[model samples]
Target: MRFPGFTGEWKETTAAETCSEFKSGKGLKAENILSEGLYPVYGGNGLRGYTSTFNHDGFFVLIGRQGALCGNINIAEGKSYITEHAIAVQANTENVTGFFQYLLLNMNLGQYSDQSAQPGLAVNKLLKLRINLPSKEEQQKIATMLSLLDARIATQNNIITTVC
Candidate 1:
């Protein structure tokens, strides 16, 4: 369904079609993580620790690749180290990154997950998942609105934490 004031139907595409890069993180060992490092080390669930090095250099979306929280989505910006348990996705274009992250967040990726003793998100399978995409302008509008809401939520949570 299209948002209010947006015209036409959204186009259906796969993650691989929209994201130029969809690769699993590599080379980072837990022992290599430094407590006093320059970059954040990201794992499946989120910031696992810090590292002296970074493999990625820009804004990208990270999906939990293997874990109980497989399919969880997170965004990484600047220089950061991503662990093998997470998949990094970079949009083919700049304007779509925020929208793509939001879409990934809304998706029931766990449904597509490989059911086993340890749950895992197959990058090949995830790449084929269909996505409905709106116009760039519509995407920007939606992203901006969501970002504002997210900021407000973070602020509210901080206030609640401080009060408690």
Candidate 2:
């Protein structure tokens, strides 16, 4: 989707150009999980635990590598700890916007998914796919705009939950 109020091309790019190495998170057992920690849990599609150890920092997006939620998208700020089933995408922000990249991924890639007895994202298909482009400035602005709406909606939902 094109960002309004900005007129620029969304150049198509392969995932290879837009991303670096995709790493998987370490597997941690639920029974051994520590309740108090600083790390954020990343899993197939949800959190399994937290840990103090980490591998990457700053903004990064994650995609489920296997399972029903395969191809599911998520983003994190600061430091994070993801699970083994998720693949990390370090955005090619120099050529695109990170937030916009995250938004763009949500459009769905199930068709490209490598079907198995168990479903999962086909890395081979996913890694080479191209996406329409957006300028970093416009991407940031669009991401911010969407983020504010999301925050507002979440707050409203919280308020409603509390009232109920």
* lDDT by residue (tens digit), candidate 1, 106-162: 996777788899999999988988888888889888988899999999999999999
Indicate the residue-level lDDT of 127 in model 1.
90
C-alpha local distance difference test of each model: 0.87, 0.70
Candidate 1 displacement at residue 79 in angstroms: 0.6
Model 2 CA lDDT for position 18: 66
- Tell me the lDDT of candidate 1: 0.87
**Quick one: how many clashes does candidate 1 have?**
0
**Cα distance off (Å), candidate 2, residue 25:** 3.3
Candidate 1 residues lying further than 4 Å off, grouped into runs, are 1-5
lDDT per residue (tens digit) for residues 1-164 in model 2: 56668887777877677666556666767754566678877776756667776656877677777877787777756787777788777766474346644564676855566778888776667777777657777767777887788789999999999999
